[model samples]
Target: MPERSSGRRPAALVIGGGMTGMLAAAVLSDHADVTVVESDVLPRLPAPRKGLPQARHAHLLWSGGVRALENLLPGITDRLVTRGARRVPIMSGMVSKAPSGQWFRRFDDARHLNLVCSRDLLDSTIRTEVLRLPRVTLRERTELIALEGDADRVTGVRVRGSVGDGVLSAALVIDATGRASRAPVWLTDLGLPPVEERVVDAGVGYASRFYRAPASTGEDFPIVNVQADPRRPPGRGGIILPVEEGRWLVTLSGTRGGRPSRDNGEFVPFARSLAHPVIGDLLAGAEPISDVVTTHSTANKRRYFEKSPRWPAGFAVLGDAVAGYNPVYGHGLTAAAQSVLALKRVLAGHALDSPETARHIQRRAARPVGQAWDLAVGQDVLYPGATDETPGRLERVAAGFIDRAVDAGARNPHALRVLLDVMSMERPPARLLAPDMLFRVFLGRKEPLLDGPPLTEAERKAAGL
Candidate 1:
């Protein structure tokens, strides 16, 4: 192990420089001088980098995530919009066909909103804001080698950077290295027990490409989505996200035998093969601007660190390090942001050197992680071969009720708001079971379901449909 100095400021060591890691650094900056160590030097502008392959795909920031960002860095929403990100109102700013085979009516509601932009743009925007903090220092090309302390506490970390191997001592250490985090292995080396983990994989794969937006599309162009039914085998789906710079980021996905292809020629065809052809039809008049990028590691995996009885102090995990959700649900960023917020809350009252401080942060962080994990895996586990263990009776009952809720929400704006409240992570999933929501779901009046994609005449003309 590399030798570490004993005397240092009350600093925090963040192990990644991605969005979540940056957010963690931003929060920790107020407590202590923070060091963000990254294996890959992040880009200074809104462009893709080697570390984040998913940056090429469509990423949505739900209202929950939007609020988290604003709370962490005030006026960030405006900064992103000034740089071309769109603050799209939920339901109204979307054209979606639910897995239940009903087209969601574009209800005139603004309570729920989503931030739409390329992942690169989102990352760069957040990174820029976080790095502006005087107390936060970013160490490029630095990689974590191991945790420095034992099972009782973590004093710092052994790391290898551009210069050589050494130790960065801190009062706290946060692992935010995404899905590839080595914390589990490092923990065991410290004589701590293995963390409980579960994985629900639907074998879903994705292929995404960018398109020059059709000339006539307005700035508020709706996001077009056709969702896959988990009850059906070889599920297929597609989405068209109107991102910054007048570009459309289109992503097509499928489970197991139906996965999309990386071939650029097959991108549009795959979109056409989804449950509905609206995504394909809209793309017909648009010109491709980038080749398709594909990924196969879409799985909902959770590490229950909070449940570990032997959890150590002075070390904590956040972001995908704690739980990596299926990107299809678009909850990863939101969950991570909320986890950082929880960390902020925990640190507000507790001293960094206090016993069980890391444990408290870890437990609070798990709250958002559990919410996101359930949402991402609820439908995934229903797919055959998604998991070894069968979903319990409660899960089955919940699924049935969710299907009914989706059906009702398609026809009733009130029910739709209730569903969006949960889906957007603005409220707990229990919100769906509230008395009023139950009445709306089971007995309230519902409008006639639209027979096709609810594209406005103006939207159709703009897409040349």
Candidate 2:
């Protein structure tokens, strides 16, 4: 953390006060005076707001992301857990149906875990903590109207507030504005060529609702997941994750024509219609607490800003502004957290006012984006009418290996360990190609695949199944 100067501190303008923006502020505050401008008036407590419609859905911080976030904000995980968020262990505390139509057994050994809670709580917790930093200022109900500088160097941002519009000059400007980011138009306005942008929309739609859990399904309840089989036309999936307040956040999803609806009547049927009927069965006995809320913008979109031949000195983009994944993958927050770490590392030794520094940060931040993008679009592109462009030779080969790996995971603990590693973002996809993992995938002795959901007798009784 290199302070810009002791006499006059360098300033930064961060657009969007969501999770990504908050993390960016936390990291930037270590190097400069940071200001976060948000269009919506943020709630003081852990409650939902107008800007984040997706907050209605469930959100989790995988172990890898939790580690990255912990590095940036110490005691953040304990803070979340103390506030009622559950740290659910992977595999051991999960009952999941793989796309290969095999129910993965709940192994006794757990390696990875994730924090499960409402997006509201996750955002609010980070917001409260990040804004308290000495040099961080939060501006509410402010709209970013335009970029302050030209194509070669970004000096600040022109924002419109309730009183009037004004330009806030800064040495660095971050666009953490999320999916609604207009960075492309903003850059083009500054005379820079548009960056390469790609969208791999599975045409996936999300339908989520909250439910009060059965009394017997106490604090230690397992997460129930029914994954969509991409091999099947119009893929569908659902999950039952226990969040704070002893309730479950159930989100059902479908691809293209098979999307789930907000109609209360169709909720359970969609869950029942998944590869496994377990989610629907569990929901049948649970009490509903919220109406079904639906969102259709679950596309995997990415802007390759780093590839641009010319990048401005004072401008950088992070989080959903750079790349956004399907919520079902649960990698958006994790990727953003990792991006913040990348930014912090880049700023450690580089001058804040250097264009090369901004370029380095942009390129490094996109590393996690590439990882999550490949993982998400690899499956999303397989959905019917997902995209017009076909997957390249490498993609097809990777997909082949993934299918075999999934089949291996269902029956083999060694294979399952590798799968969980990649799924939890602890390891890269190349880990599956390691010699030992390849040996297990090809020659390891396999246990019999499960014919149905692998729930214990006590677990079934608790859910009143």
Candidate 3:
């Protein structure tokens, strides 16, 4: 490892204090002094911050992400559960309506699960863990103005205080400022060419609200989802996630003309009108806790910085800054966690000042980003008015294979395990393309497809339906 000047600890400056930035700071703190700069005042508790409006919506920490986060911050999952996040076992703990039909009976042997909770709680828990590191300091109410070095290398960032224009410098800089980052322009100011970018907008919109869980069910309710079928002409979906505080976070979404409404009165009816009305039925018995919140920023965007021939040393981008996916896929947080894990791996074997550390880290992180981007954009492109990026022959073949796998999985336990593994991010998508999986796909649905939500009589009575 290259030693810092006079054997002193190197310093790293992180722009943005969101989950990704906080995780980055935590990982970097082990090897250097880290400071996190945030443009908004962070809430001391698991509450909403000004910058993350999406916090009002539901978010899931898939099992793969949970494992990565635990690796980064041990015992964080237990802490999150203690605070209200539910550990929902995959397939078994979910009631899903798929395009092929209802999901089959999930076996107990499933290895993955999803962490269901509000985005605020998830971010706050991560923020708390990162701040507990003694070597990490936070400078809230500060914004990055520009990079402090040239095209060959970035020495630091020029940040203006939220109250004033005071600036600070460090040895390395990380841009985790999210989808709205200005790093491309900052690099251009240093005479670098524009970074390559790709955008696949689905014209997707979201409307969500909080509802107090039904008294009969208490706390520990399973997540219910009515998924959209992209094979259909129009795309629409809904999900009801059991969150902390004995509440359910319900989100309804649509693409193009099928968009859900922001009107509170229309929420239930809109949900009922979805391909499956289970979500609407479940919400009928719950008490509303919040008004409908709506947003329309579900674009799958990627900035190809690693492919840029001349990336500056001592600088890197992570999380939404590198790629922002369609939120409907619920891959944003997981992708961020995966990126942070990649950063830690790269730093463990290389020095921050090494000639190729940043480039190598970016390349490794790109793997997860590419996986998520492909999944999101591939489906989004099929929706009418979603994008003009025509699906090539390869994309169509992949989609057909996935569709077959999903149909098979809905009835075959072996096939379900493969689908669950990929959905949880525990394994790569290629796992579904394995020879065994392909054979299962050929066999197709072994049992009759379910016609509706497979709810037990007890659950039906509890929901007052």
* The candidate that achieves the highest lDDT relative to the unseen native structure: 1
> Where is model 2 more than 4 Å wrong at Cα?
1-7
Residue-level lDDT tens digits of model 1 in 1-465? 222224555889999999999999999998789999999979999998999999998899999989988898889999999999999998799999999899999889888879999999999999999999999999999888899989999999998889899999988999999999989999999999998999999999999999999989979889999999998879999899999999999989999999998998888888889888999999999999999999998999999999998977889999999999889999999999999999998888787766678999999999989999989899999988999988889999999999999999999999999898888888999999999989988899989989999999999999999
| Error at 249, model 3, angstroms | 0.1
Kindly indicate the candidate among 1 and 3 with the higher lDDT: 1
Candidate 3 lDDT: 0.85
Residue-by-residue lDDT tens digits, candidate 3, 1-465: 543334678889899999999999999998889999999999989887779998898789888888899999999999999998888887777778775455665556647767888899989988988898999999998888889889988888777885687556666788999999998999999989999998888788899999988988766566788888777746789998888888889999988888888899999999998987889888999999899999998888999988898888888999999999888788889989999999999988887767678788889999888877877887877766566757778988888877888888887878998887787677898898898898889965477777777666777788887
TM-scores for all predictions = 0.98, 0.97, 0.96
The stretch of ten residues in a row with the least summed lDDT in candidate 2 is 1-10
Tens digit of per-residue lDDT, candidate 2, span 197-255: 99988888899999999989899889998888887868899999899998999999998
lDDT of each: 0.91, 0.89, 0.85
Ranking by lDDT: 1, 2, 3
- Residue 66, model 3: lDDT of 88
